[model samples]
Structures are given as C-alpha cells and as structure tokens.
Target chain A: MMDFISYTCLIVGVIFWFWGTIPLLSERSVLFKLHSLSVSDTLGSMSIIFGLLLKIPREWPLLVLAIVCLVLWNTMLGYVLAYCSSSGEKRENR
Target chain B: MVGHLIFRLTIWFLLTANLSWLNILIGLSISLLLPRGYTNPETLKEWLSILGKILWAIPLAYIEAFDLILRPHNDEDMVCEQVEKKRSHRLVFLDILLITFTPKTIVVKYHEEGWYEVHRVTRRKKP
Candidate 1:
C-alpha cells in the first residue's frame, strides 16, 4: 500500500511539472507563464517531498523542513519576480 | 516572554528531532539568546480561526489549480474585473499567497485607489 501511494505521488508530481511547462510554449503573457510555472512547480515539488516523507519516516524532520522551505521561498520568489517585472514596465511607460 | 521562549525551544526541538541532552542544552541557549519578537494574540479564538482559514485555503488552492490545469478555458470566470475596496495588508498578503499558490490567477498590478489588476487564463468571447 505504501509503495503504491509513494509511486502515485511521484507520478503525479512529474505530471504537474509537465503541466506547468506546457504554457511556456504558447504565446501567453509573461506573468501568465510565470504563474503557471511557479505554482505547478511548487506543488509538484511539495508532493514529491511528501511522498519521500512517507517513505522515510525516520528523516521526517528534514522532509518537513524541505516542504516548509519550498512553500515560503516559492511564494516569496514569485512576489519578487512580479514586482520586478511590474517596476520595469512602470519605468518604460514613464 | 517565558512562554515565547518555550515555544521557540519546542520548535527547535521539533525541527532537529533530537532528544539528546547536548541538543537540548544548545537549543535552550540558542532560543534564549535569540531576540524576542513574538506578538501576543488578542484571543485564542482569533488565532484558531486564522489557522483554520489557512488550512482550508490550502485545499481550495489545489482544487482551483487542478481545475485550471485541466481546463484552462475556465480562467475567464475566475478573473475579477476590478477590486475597488481597500483591503488590509494582512488580507491582501493572504489573498496574494493563496492566488499565487494556485495556477488560476496571477496578480498583474496594484493600481491606485485600491484597485488590483489580476490576469486569468481563460477563453474570450468572440466579437
């Protein structure tokens, strides 16, 4: 049962990663692409980490830490990227 | 202050997952040495409700994300035209975090007069 769950999580994580990338090839706006990529990547990474946590309960502390770091850093990075992109637009418009 | 110190030490212990005397000693000293920055909550009920909201937001985010990824055309309904009312900093931050965590919405800009421009990936109506 555990093996099945672990494999499922890993598979889903990989699928999400690919799902996020599909937008990059299209002619969407930069922000749209960034949003799709970042959110999917974060969720994929988290799901994989969670699978690992289940597989290796002994190292749960580190795995949990990894999850927290992924969540906090990914969100912060997105905000920073958006801010920088917006500010550049402002300078160009002025 | 004592309560804060204990909370910090407990977190340290949980992160390390070590129960050795040396680990405890080091954690105790480190926690004590760290600057005090914990803010007292007005009420436990308020804190619990905030935590509950966050917990609920996580699942909602996943549902929205999956829907967007599977059906990208639904983005039109998700996107808001404009938000005229001012939101508190805390609320704005939470909304941004929740929206960004999901693939459905991306905050484009914060225009003047409390207006927020968000972009959603959805199909447009043909003229």
Candidate 2:
C-alpha cells in the first residue's frame, strides 16, 4: 500500500508540473502565467518530495527541509517576479 | 525573540539532521550569532494563527490548482486590499506569500497607505 501511494504521488506531481508548464506557451500576461506556474510548480515539487519521504523515511529530515524551502522560496520568488514585472510596466507608462 | 531563535534552531537541526553534541554546539552558536533586525511586538496567538493559515493554504492550494486546470479563466482584475495599521514586515511578507501561493491571486504592489494591489484571475461559471 505504501509503495502504491508513493508511486501515485510521484505520478501526480509530474502531471502537475506539466499542467503548470504548458501555460508558458500561451500568449498570456506575465503575471497570469506566473500565478499558475508558481502554484503548480511548488505543489508538484512538494508532492514529489513527499513521495520520496514516504519511500525513504530515513531521509525525512532532508525531505522535510526541501518541502519547507520549496514553500517559502517559491512563494517569495513568485512575489518578487510579479513585483518586478509590474513595476517595470509602471516605469514605462510614466 | 525566543520564537525567532527557536525557528532558527529548528532550521539548523533540519539542515544538519544530526544529534551529536558537536553539531548541536555549532548550530546553536551559529544561530545565536546571526544578526537579527528590529522586531515588532506580535502576540504568539496571532503568529500561530497565521502559521495555521499557511498550513491550511497547502491543501487549499492543491484544490485551487485542480480548479484552475479544469476550468478556463474568464478575466483578470487588479484589486486593492486594505491592510491593518501597524503591520509588521513579516506579516506583509506572509500575506503576499499566501496570496501568491494560491493559483488565482498574486500581489502586484504594496502601497504606503497600507493597501495591497492584487492581481486576480476569475474563472468561468458552469452552465
């Protein structure tokens, strides 16, 4: 059962990664694309790491650290990117 | 102050993943030696509530991601949200983090007037 769940999580994470990346190809606003991309990518990476943690419980500390870093840094990075892009647009308009 | 120290210590232990005395000593000293900025007085209850909200956002984020994938977005809007008076930088940072962590909203700017310029994506309604 554990193995099955681990595999499922890994598969779902990969699917999330693809779902998020596919939007980059579309002609949407930068912030719009970023919103989807950041959300899915962070979720996908966390899910994958969680699956690994379950598979190898011995390395749980590292895996947990990875999840924490992903959540904090990915969110911060997304905000920074959005802020920079929007501020640039404002500068051009003014 | 104590909370920040504990948080740093937790990160140190997570990074080292060891319980050796030497490792503990090093981690303790490093965390203590790190310079900290001025901190505003925030109640522990408020901090924990925010932390709980962040934890809750994880599951909610997954749900929102699925919702985004299944439905097409109808339009995007820029909305301004008022923030509390005497807000700490940490609170503002977490606010932006939580908003952007979810699939539908991203904070564009934080104004001096205690307002956040948020960009949100609205999805289509079901027929």
Best by TM-score: 2
lDDT of 2: 0.87
Chain B TM-score of candidate number 1: 0.54
B1-127: candidate 2 lDDT, tens digit per residue = 8887899999999998999999999988998899999968788888998999998998999998888878878578889998786878888788888988888888888887799999988874445
Question: Candidate 1 regions off by >4 Å?
Answer: B1-11, B36-43, B74-95, B107-119, B123-127
Best by lDDT: 2
Clashing pairs in 2: none
| Alpha-carbon shift of residue A17 in model 1 (angstroms) | 0.2
Q: Each model's TM-score?
A: 0.77, 0.94
Worst 10 residues of 1 chain A by lDDT: A30-39
Interface RMSD per candidate: 2.5, 0.9
